[model samples]
Target: MVASKRNRVLAGMMLAIGFAALRSAPAAEVAAVLRAPDFKLSDQYGQSLSIQYPRESACVLIFADQRGSSQVEGWVRPLYSRYQGRVTISGVAELSSVPSALRTMIQGIFKKTIQFPVMLDWTGRVSRQHEYRGKAAAVVIVDPQGLILHRETGKAAVEALERCYEVLDGLVRTEDETPPTAPQDGPAVEQAQRQSRQNGAGGAVRQSDQAKK
Candidate 1:
């Protein structure tokens, strides 16, 4: 009888804990001023870094698992280069399921190919704090005041990222003539086709080239 009573009490406590978690808003949406929490991890070169160190105008934290590396080259790599000094782009690898050596290998591939700072998040503490999910996730765009201007999830479209840069740049512009914030006029569908051929996405390359002429 005592055992049964103890079991009932345990179950009630579990239910209460679950309910509290459910009722709480996720960590990501919580707004705050001052410095964002710092995450320290080993980069590809085996050097340690935190978000607070090496201050820049902006920062991008990309939380990528193994699978997302495939797409990182075609898309993510260019952005890192484009925003190099202006924005510090840091990649965090979700290494829970991966071996340490294999994680290092994956980081090597990215470094050799993209040459950006990619960190390893073995405990997933950073991921959960920033509310990361799935294969590719990112956040942590801080303004000059050290306030986060954009904390987003998932890989947003290239156009969306472009718009973000434009707005941020505009904010710092001192000229009397400021450029109008244009709507998302994406690469013309036909133009993308032509460029895709030149860059070689590996389908209809020659045919697209002939069509472009």
Candidate 2:
């Protein structure tokens, strides 16, 4: 009788452990850090984007809805333009935080206005993972290789965002450091190609002469 009871207790413990494992959600956000919770989403252009924050270079991410979408063009695009290929710019549409009735209407408006990759956080899973307190929006600047450099919530003014931009600029590699790589058709590569062709021709001629002998 004791052996049967022991087995039943063990089985109950196992069942509880399994249930707890199943009920767990993704990890919560790590503040002031670039251990950015990964997310896969589609943008307005139907482009599939997977963000693993703190890439090779700095990146700026905006989590918002229609409330702050309009201002993206004003301040955000300038960041994109200033940084150009130096920094990454992305946005997340926090539709799950919006009212059900207003979701569609807000989505339609931003879809037309936003230029950069605005990922749809449909269930707010991504937002929750990032711990986005529901404000008009939240912005984070991460340095290259993923360190949270700056974070802001609400309508962060252009000047204030620019101050954050300077932080990102300091982290970016200088032009002399990260020059544009030359194409394969550059002078050095073209010279190498010419030499390769000459070597092949010489080898063929030598083979023909030996055959003639």
Candidate 3:
């Protein structure tokens, strides 16, 4: 009888521990330090992208829809222009009412006008994961490690983007001091071409040696 009672007590303790873990799990925005959550999503080109991908001296900038403002096309476009290849720019549509076609067009417009990577987050999971507050906002300056290095919620003046660039550049300088690792895949776009050449040459070399034999 004593053993059975002890078993019951042990079970109760386990349940309490599990409850505590669930309560302590990180929630976006509320957590004190900004940690980037890894997520997989498709980009404008329908290519799979993940937060784990290594970036060379670049940051991720997210812009979302706001309540009062329809869309600040002019402001965002120039920011894209000035920073073009140096940074990856993405627009997140927070509203449930947004249509797929509209999202695609907006992405296309930015891809052409801004000439940078643009991503669509239909479920707002990315926004929530990043801990973005406010009905609509812009969160600029995510590091290559996917950490939220700097964030500005409201309408960021032209200076905001530039400031983010400075932060990222500083980070790159710091990383340069560290020991080297595997070869960088270079920028996100060039990665595909790099991989293609590697794969094509890799098999051809084996075949050529066989023919020589």
Please report the candidate that would top lDDT against the real structure: 2
Off by over 4 Å in 1: 1-35, 53-56, 99-114, 170-213
Where is model 2 poorest over a 10-residue stretch in terms of lDDT? Answer: 25-34
| RMSD list, candidates in order | 14.6, 17.7, 18.8
Per-model TM-score on C-alpha atoms: 0.53, 0.58, 0.49
Window of ten residues with lowest summed lDDT in model 3: 24-33
**Model 2, CA-based lDDT:** 0.71
How do all the candidates rank in terms of TM-score, highest first? 2, 1, 3
lDDT of 3 by residue, 99-202 (tens): 77687675675567644444656666776777655465665566676667676555555565566556657766675687767665668749888899999998
For candidate 1, list the clashing residue pairs, or say none: none
Question: For model 1, how many clashes?
Answer: 0
lDDT of 1 by residue, 5-99 (tens): 99999999999999999876332432354455666887777889887733535666666666654544443566665665666666777767767
At residue 195, candidate 2 shows an lDDT of 100
Q: Rate the local accuracy (lDDT) of all candidates.
A: 0.63, 0.71, 0.62
How many pairs of residues collide in each model? 0, 1, 1
The CA lDDT at 171 in model 1 is 36
Q: Which candidate's TM-score is highest? A: 2
lDDT preference between candidates 2 and 3, better one: 2
